[model samples]
Target: MAANILTDPGLMPELRRVDHGFFGPDSVAWRVWTHPSILIGLQRAVAVQFLNPFFTAAHDDAQAIYKYPGHFYDMTLGFLLSGILGDSRTALQTSDFIMRIHTRATGIEPISGRRYHANNPETQLFTHIDGWQSMLKCYEVFGPGPLSPADDHRFWNECATAAELFTCKPDDIPRSRDGVREYYATLRPQLCVTEAALSGMRQLLATSGPNSTAKLAAFSRFATPATLITLPSWMRRLIGFDQPAAVDRAYLPFMRGLLGTLNKSKRATRTTVRLAAPISGRILRQHWAAGTPRRAEVATVAEARKLYRQELRDENGFSSDTEYTAAH
Candidate 1:
């Protein structure tokens, strides 16, 4: 995939543009992603990054990050793999687990809120699972081989219960929200395995084939808009939502500068093809390689303990007697 991306004359320019946007000086996305304090601030920024489109659709950042040209790659590749590799069972299971996490993480009842949050992680996970089931159904209809029993029961059950909860219209429990806030405030921890799993998934899919690359590019594009829409409302308020002009004035110059660099590089006669392609490819490959699979990686709970122990060993670090809270 790296080799193809590097050698493809047509893709190099666009890929270069993407790299510039992600890594260049004007990159708000890069700035937030690489911040040292990846806590409330970064989380809020990320949420805003994903949700900018629904609230404000006038800018290039919204389009670039959320809705670009290639957007169906991941679903397509997943489907392709299931058809060819006979691993739909595994993919379905994996999708189910991720969907459950999404449900819990987003605090949304998956089945009832399915339509409104169709692009939400939880809904998307279910969609992926449904796709797998549909594939099984297709196999039953067309193929001579025996079809696998549908694994939809558990998912359906959960979704149904979630829908019932939604129908019940539970009263707004202020105390519950307060408790959640307190819990998160004390547990300043990152889900290391989740990060690792996503990373590994990307790497595995990237190395799969040219089709996989296309799938990834497509999936990212399609998923970007939903990400923007589902971002917390608070983030929009923080970024001077009322002062659109000011926000643009503060940020657009950087974007323009980066875009200019990309445009210049594309037109440069001396620019070698090999160098252009590999720069972004290397960065992406390294990122994916670092990610661990969900099944293989240590739990976040365990990783937090290890981090605490390392911190304790430092002379300037908090003393053993000092209490520490998990910071997500």
Candidate 2:
């Protein structure tokens, strides 16, 4: 997401390894989720979650969720980026961090007459399925997808396997494309726009905050409209988003142009996870030592920068004598 970490020094680990985690360099989920166009897929997933009544209600009441909504979105994106491309150890650490966060997201639901927790298996299942569908769906629409029917099936199956790596239930995983379609169909009756969902969606799409730089802010603006336009028409209607005929007519060409831009540079999209280890291990151990008494250590920006560069060289696969010769 931040300028081809696949090739960046000081930020990327050895990422061509095949055994890093669940979906390796060879897996379709990795291929699908790591691409630049995954931006659209992730945006789709964020928009779709509000249709869940319980999630909508909980999110509406949680002020922390709104105060920095864009940051919240970016944090999730970072988690996914670091997890998916990171080696086995890094992936595990990020997963643990996310799970710990989810455990705290519990609340009572007035409508369903049940308690809602972000880490609840059922809720996790819902989010996973929606997220999975949105990623694959948008890839097919906006990226180099619409895979051969065989690869398409493999994509969905690989995603199921990826899901199992997290907190997914074996019984709830959709192991095939048809299973995903059937699952969504079954949930259709339950999907509706609550006042909370509507309000959140509005704000979510309205603007990027002041903290975003101009370039990031512009992309943030394009992201909402493009993602909304890219979602299935039935979904747009289901969630009470309207697509005027004129907007639809204009958006298709714009999407085609945008997708063309993505297509033009395949090198930028190539990202991989290392087979043998985690990329973030050193960063976590040295700087973010969660349990260490030395956590209070702080430094000026210049010291921090020097320390980071040294750490990157030391832990990210290079000797002190080899910095100039090593190619990312």
Candidate 3:
């Protein structure tokens, strides 16, 4: 098969990063990512991170392939998956690699008159928090269904623990959906999407669909419009995703309905989730074949996705309950 070159390693790794953390298979974060509509929150989290101007300044527009939305799905999933599922040693390596990369991500924010470093704990905290919030948003709206407020509180607490790897203190993070709402209340004063940020956004969106042929890539491109519908009015305005309010209102229901129906099938949804990489690879190949003329090399998506699926299966095993938790 075309994906075998990437999955040539015969067996899955035995160790896991979350074996001792609250984010273990029993956690809500696990439940959120394994859901049929996992991609929904994952994409939204990427968009939400850019709402912070300092974070936005870190994206280099010239590196369209790297900064492109087509690539966002894998990159984001890798970050979370490494921390959430990789062995402790691998997880630490991944964290350190990111910190080292961010060390060079220092820049001046023209609008805020502030210097920003991707490694900055507070900045990283904003990203961690936003991601947790987005995960919950997608799971509630697209996955199995809405979780209880009490469960939401427990989920947020667990998320904070996992996110502590990024420097979030337990108290500094929200503990419930309402707390997330309040957390955003505080950030309203500090957040604004500037033209430079908007340009960075454009770089991402412009490459959204044309860059890959993987079904997941196509799904991501399709989700872009619906994800935009979910973005806060302020965030949408910042990036200039100006569809009429009526359009957004119409999109939300249709997307929710589509994803909900898919959630009804355990086999189909799991297959889609597991195929993220091959889908991404197919997307890339399609782009090259269709006159996109790739300028640089991207590590094989099939291989990356193969490893991810192996780890996920090893951790959770094959369970029927779509909401089934991996035995810790």
Candidate 4:
């Protein structure tokens, strides 16, 4: 078995860098995210995230998802992994890019007759927590064994730290598994199914987005079912992703085998990254070229964020931090 290009710096020289960014190698985030199976989790979250009508509407209006599903998926995953694995500078730049994207994704939501903004704390928090939940859920069931109780708690706690990359404050993110469930339960009643949401979900599940090759579509036959089974039946039904229990039973082993191979085989991981590179986001591509820090220097989210701010200030010739913030 070869090493994963994303994790082993020996393969991805760019991964070799000094700063560990927000989460260190020992953190639960790095532990789970480095696994190949988390890619499934990310795909699953792409569908699940649209369960929010506002999010779906915003995405639909932006013409990012339905119009360009494969691009949307790859770009989202690219930015996400960059934030997790890139050094402090890359992560902060990725976050700023996301913020700009969110800023422009604002409009009247057709269903509720209310305006929707992607950066709204409620929306951002939902996306942030749901993504973490999806990643960890898939990682446990298929990638690696489940975390211990303490580690499980730490995963959720660390999720808050990761949330700093987005608009959400740490306090807004759930610190426990139960807190996540409670947050979802509270948000469930407000979630409504819309045609845009269903259409976007179908596009994602089919992998039939613009510029998606036939090979990718063929792979989606196996990958989509695996992605669907990761979601709970209720949520699946809510978003019209209905995979039978028998399908789940039949595909579970294959999914596990496929992901396990990717986790272990360097050639497989490298191939996957190469396939995804065409649609990768700018920050992720830049990070790949520039590489991360070589030394494992850990920094708190706040401290790392200040570095980003300082760099931004220097680049733009902002006279003060306040001016930098305002300009941004």
Candidate 5:
């Protein structure tokens, strides 16, 4: 995408050996993230992300997505995949790459004249939490049904761990469903749809495979409403994504059937990879290529960070961002 953005850091060998980089293989994060249906949540999360006028304003000013939509998605998906599935080094570096990009995304909101920076902890926190919530909620609804209460708690706690990559303190993130609801409650009053945000939302929903083939176009058609229906009715209405209540009711069964059949066929994950390749392929494809190792060391995010900390030292002779790699 961006000329400075290095999609591959040549860490797949290490990534392949990592039994558990940050979240363990046994983690609720892995259980939820590995599902093909998580794409629905990711799509809807982008819509919700645009609801924050400031956040939308920052992105609108940057226009990175507008300039290079295909590369933009590829990088987004890459960051998500590497952070979730990569080794400590890969995950940490990918997070840094994203934050570095954010540092340049700054502008003043047109409506309130308030300054906005993508690196702001508040905006980053909203994005982090919304994405986790959307993916898990979508999985519960469309994929395998609800998780155990204990597992849900674990998932949210793991979300906090992942927040280390963002400007937010991991401790400030919610660790339970009730906590998340309360977190959003405080922000709800601050959120409103703006014309710019509405346009951005529509554009994000319209994304398709790079080829724009018929099948992919049809999938995009189905996916837009599918993601819209997953939003809370209030959110849907507020964002102008509301559908007829009857359509909402009817689509649920159809989606459940479609996603269920795919999951059962064991082709869902592979299909997701293929579909994502055109627009956003490298990171996910790399992760898929790495595959799961049967035996290797597992480490907590903190532990893994410490393990890789020395690897990133500038004195260690790594180049600047363009060629930085965990491999030495």
Candidate 6:
């Protein structure tokens, strides 16, 4: 049967509410959960980090860039897909969307004088680089399947051509500083075309029925776990869960609900979970590993669910157990 949620737009708002409750205000996590643009940028960054093992090796610098902006986008993509598909199309469409945005944002078109403060040159520039890097990574993975090598080369050429126009020294590319009107002007056309293309592509893909369904299913896996882990740390801490145990306590039910949902959803096929399990495990093990004291405190899946239900009783709130077991 077709999923009830596949065509529902109202669900987006509920997803946002869940996200807000998990991330909280004043935390860096809000930027990604609330903003589509920032979230796209982050997905691009994760694509880059995933493809380029160098970033993984350079963990400290990578974490610094990723924590605020990069992590936000990663979580956003994960959340969006989690709410939509889970892990079915993990990086495919997301990478495509981000690349399309990058292609337009960094192109040579002029920006209209009346744009938001956030759409200034610096933001566009940083987003451009992040997008280009991500697109390259996507090209490395899925691009080769549907696109010709010539197409890949041409795309990279366009990206390089755009990058050169806005840079001075080879390494000193202009980025979002304070008020970057000129940069925005340059990016306007590319951004417009890119967005249009993305819309068209989304529509076309959406109509493809089974393929679209499978892709979205793949995406959901990546989305759910990342949201369960990342958001609560920031939100609960903001809500006064200073102790690691308290923070973990607050996050238990949410995680269990998340995992249980994944286990039950029609989208949660073997391919989806199998593909996602390694990525999820790696992210959890990496962040929650012993080196980082805060991250180190996160519990395993079994432990998290047990504790989550315990806290549900303490708060006198019904747990998602009914839903969880019903799915089984």
Cα RMSD for predicted model 5: 4.4
Q: TM-score each candidate.
A: 0.20, 0.72, 0.71, 0.85, 0.85, 0.24
TM-score of 2: 0.72
Lowest lDDT 10-mer window, candidate 5?
1-10
Look at candidate 1 and tell me the lDDT of residue 201: 26
| Model 3 residue 325 CA deviation in Å | 34
- Cα lDDT for residue 228, model 5? 77
Per-residue lDDT of candidate 4, residues 196-311 (tens digit):
88887777777675567676566556568888877877887787668778989988888788788887864565466546433333333334355445666867778866656766
RMSD of 3: 12.3
Clashes of 6: 22
lDDT of 1 by residue, 165-271 (tens): 11121121112223324533342231112232333223322223333345444433332322223223443343322324454454444433433343344233112
Candidate models: Cα lDDT each: 0.27, 0.58, 0.57, 0.71, 0.71, 0.31
Model 3 scores what on Cα lDDT?
0.57
Runs with alpha carbons beyond 4 Å of true place in candidate 4: 1-18, 276-295, 313-328
- Model 6, span 31-124: residue lDDT tens: 2222222222333344322222222222322232223332333343443333222111211222223322232232222233332221234443
At residue 134, candidate 4 shows an lDDT of: 90
lDDT of 6 at 229: 35
lDDT of 1: 0.27
Superposition error at 55 for model 5 (Å) = 1.2
Q: lDDT: which is higher, 3 or 5?
A: 5
Worst 10 residues of 3 by lDDT: 1-10
The residue ranges of model 2 lying beyond 4 angstroms of the native Cα positions read: 1-19, 208-217, 266-328
Q: How much RMSD separates candidate 4 from the native structure? A: 5.4
**Per-residue lDDT of model 2, residues 1-328, tens digit only:** 1222322435444332223444444667666765556666666787888888877766776744367654556555555655554444444444444554565577887678788776666666888788878877777777775777777777776566545435666557776778888998998888888777887776566544554345445555676667887777888887777668787678767776776575555432332111111222222222112232222232222333234444443444344444312221
Which pairs of residues collide in model 4?
A: 2-266, 17-292, 17-293, 17-294, 17-295, 18-293, 18-294, 18-295
